[model samples]
Target: MVHPDKASTDRTCSCRINTNYIPLKLLYLFFIGGQSCATTYRSLFMRHLGMSTQQTGVIWAFERVVSVIIPPFIGALSDKSRHPKAVLITLFLVGAVTLSSMYFVPQEESLNLTNSNVSASENVTAATHVDIEEYGQTFWLLVVLVFASSFSVVGIYPVLESTVLGVLGPQNRYKFGHQRLWASVGYGGAALIVGYLKDRSAESIGDMTGTNRAFLSMFAGVMVCYCCAAIVSAKLPVRVKRDHEGFRFQDLKIFLKKPDACAFLGLLFFYGIDSAILEIYLFWLAEVKFETPSFILGASTFIGAALDIPFCLAAGYLTKRFGHKTLLCFGLGVMALRTFLSAIVVNAWQLVATESLRGITWGLMFVVICSYTSKLSPKGLEASCMGIMQAFLFGIAYSVGALAGGAIFNLMGGEFLFILCGSATFVATVAFGMFSFLVKKKPYEMKDPGDCTSSLAFGKEVAESSADVL
Candidate 1:
């Protein structure tokens, strides 16, 4: 028989746990929905503004660098903050302001430099056609706004994921996919709507060009969604740190000594390369190579994001059945397939069909990576671990991929680039799968201080074997 006091306490705890679900779902919906508004069509926006592919890639690479540098610091700060929700609110506001500012940046009217070679072939002297100083100023302003947005936007993910994981606690971690699925719903819905709005805006005759019209609608949606997310963030349960007082650099040594962690980070870098290539260039292929309409491009993202919803909902079951490492390999394999198909597709619809695999590649992959990282992180360093993981996945790896992709696309064209990305992903996936099979390391656990020696010894042995294999 349960004592009255104990039963009451259990009921209260259960109620608190139940309350987090709605807010978590809404948070994912609004935040990711906000990002999808601009992210899906950003390349097109810049292109419409007369910026060259290389210029856009440079901006993207710089933005990713900021993502790498900012997240770890933000994560650490969030971990230590007495009011973590306030930190999130501030990030939301910063992102809202900076991203919206991009919509207002004046579009380059006279210069249409799509490639460096084009600029040379046209024999266009900047002094004859346009003022070089004014052009440089406009371009640099876009860069500044994008960089400012990056500081807040990229930093938000790690802190948000850590907070969600902390709220769900260890036992309920798998249910993360359930909460995250709402992001797909929000993203898909918003993408579809925004795409429709862009088409409508494009059809209208006005002083503003179609790109500016589309961007105005996108910025409006982004701002509204972010503001709503900020408002809802206040209701989030503040995580109480019980195991340690604050995050310390020493806590990270435990993570660095684990061979599995090291290997996973390495895998994340390659994964970032594959993903970055796809995200940056796929639309370019459809729009430029195949002449796909804006609405169809938007429809493709909607379809992909819609597929993500089901996959995300089933992520927990899939993780349990196949395991994290296997699922990661599977996701990589699927990415390779997508890229290979993208290289061959002669039309936009077929490309869209191939992109339908986005759900399997991203939705399953994201949940598994976050869960695995959370499992590996030390108690007080959850946010820090997530931040580092994001740095590798989005920042460093993405920067490399973006720069390389841009150069390759300029020199060799999109088909060859996609083929190269496919082959690289395939090779990396196979290698990582084989490595994990040979490693057979015990699953990571938060160890007591006394267990450090044994853990370090095991890590050393694993490292030695890995070096021998290499």
Candidate 2:
């Protein structure tokens, strides 16, 4: 028979683990799953609606511009707010509605064209006028919807990361990979399922065009997943440990003074540019060059995401063994190779093989960057740090990539664009290594006595504060 105290201890430990892991797992699974359901196919949907690649790029770049302006403020707000979870849930709901609504916008070909008793030239002119008006309206509407969705989704991402880090506390941060791997599972699985369904005949899905109806079906899945995610967001243990010295916007300057920190941020910006180009144009390349099927494209993504599971699980170990600076170089080196391979791949299967290297570049890199950012974060200002990171990675850099990549792809072609990106990444990786070697490490001296270390205390404080609120 087990000793009574020991048994109680075991039970308590199990409960604590469950309380921390289960809700976050479900939140990631459903939230990312919902996003993947639509995100993987969004570009295709825009293309199907008669939008040119440049037009699509313009829309994406515009949204990234908004992300630049909004996410940091939202992160600051979350840090200051007593009820950050409520704000996150509200963002989720808004993002879900706006993103899903994009699918239901009337297709360009569906515009009314019937006109009786007109000369041929007159009719042609009238048709051109109607087409221009409709195209402009549709384009602007899609842009608005995309902006709204991006504002909520991008703004919430860093805050969500802060919540996860806060809940896990500093000691258990190594397990972040385990938590993040669930997002890959959700992404890969959703892509696989939706792709399979999308590949089905039009007759089976009750529409003459398989792609259009498939996206409509995806809208329903997004709503269900988002609703579930919002419900579970309430369960997240987000405690705001009120610091006597409140986080000021200017406090970030002190944190940025470290040479290594500045290098990392610069790396992220350039890395963002290369990654955005791939994200925006890779599938389009596969489709246009090799006539890749929807299911094959999905399979490619599934394969890459599946690799993320293993890579993410290994991230902490890799960082522990090689250190963050080494791993950053390694990840960038891998990205350069991947981009170079993308330029030369002649077949869809080869494209998939090359893309699967994202396990290292995207998956491992994400974990490393997030962990590094967390490590560098000042006490009581974790959200602000993550927000700035997101702004650099996804907002400003992504916008530049989208706009520049589109122009490059139009002028020089996709293969040439990838080659240029790959070469630039390789050069950046080398430059970063040289910079890190030259720059001396600065000792972090806190300007204020109110500050503390990176370690976060969670659980009981959260429970007590939540109870008081309730």
Candidate 3:
């Protein structure tokens, strides 16, 4: 009964929509798979390497900063040449190599400069089975190894994200939350397994030397996983041609002209530090509050990645419904509430509940944060926005926060340290909500090209409080 002309129009529309969603689906699967593989094992690797809480925190912050700083120029080059994939792939290859080296570096004892005065080296020395450093080569090699890793990732992550975004289109693009959720799933699975290993090994490898070997093995696992991810990354779909428009430093400057962009970055920056705080402290929290065995600490992380799936799926639905910023605000609220509740834990069971809280707060929030950022950048400006996000939030601020977290954890006394950590999350949540509110009196649609493909398609039509997700 439909008119012939209308039927033809409908057919064409359906065709375009199919064309749009299919590529994005593959892109999402690939991205999630690769990211999970990379983040999950990589996280376990860092934890195993005997990096101090302070060192790990700073490393995380620096990694973000370095990633932001270097990628723009590299991405600009890739963009100008119409080959975003070129730069991204090159970085991946480098990452595969650099990450491989970390496995061999000797694990060291986590530095406890701020730690409570405990038994000195001499007290444990007599009972210790073997010295961790025989030739001492492992200790010195660690510094070089980490530097390579930091450099390789800095080169790859932004470019990989930008290309994926570019290919997905604007409307109903690949979902960032979905991708992040999988990454967490990967992380959680590894954490749980490692938790059991650490727990079981404790009595057998009570010696520090034996424990170092187990930790070193974890680094090896990360390198293998990352190498595979790099190989998969090479096959992602992004055309290697510059667009009609030219890219220059001026394009990077466009971020300042967009308030939504600034506001989102501010939220991201604070949230980055807050999440970093949770990650660095979760194990310690487990030990102090639960009196848990090391095995339990390892077990909790085993589930970090798995738990992220629901949040990732939710992010997709939420981005389609309440919008990314609103979802982020909501997530932050949930996290702050969890942290505040955690401040009052009375038993080990309560500690387990706190881990769940940590996962939800940091893990799920990671989903929309990256996606919203992707949605707010102008075309070809994905790297710059990513860079700026890294520069402000993750790089210096987080690095400092990591250092501060360790200092404060030592200085403040554990009895009430939960309050301090919770306070940071709450403040960040408050800042995010307040600034987001004051940005506009009403909802408005604004589009920015992201590091995802779908952001370019239907999302091309941006609006406040509503999204054009297919």
Best by TM-score: 1
Tens digits of per-residue lDDT for model 1, 145-247: 9888997889788778877766766545545676788888888888788878887887683555534765677888889989999998998876766553444
TM-score, model 3 to reference: 0.73
Highest lDDT against the true fold, candidate: 1
Better of 1 and 3 by lDDT: 1
- Count of clashing pairs, candidate 1: 0
lDDT by residue for model 2 (1-470), tens: 99999988865654444455677878888888888886777777776665556666787788888887687777767767767798889988998899889877765553445356767556544544454445566578898899888878787786777777677665555566668887888888887777777767334766443246756656776888888889999998776767623336676696698677788888887798888788888887877798777788889888998899878766755765676778898899898889889889978888789879989997899988886776677765655677777887889889988888877876688899899999999999999989877877554444222122221212332222222111
Clashes of 2: 0
Model 3, 86-151: lDDT tens per residue?
A: 565566567667655565555554333223464554423421212232313333465466566666
Model 3, position 404, has a per-residue lDDT of 67
| Model 1 pairs in collision | none
* Candidate 2: regions farther than 4 A off: 1-17, 109-135, 201-211, 244-247, 440-470
Candidate lDDT (C-alpha), each: 0.75, 0.74, 0.54
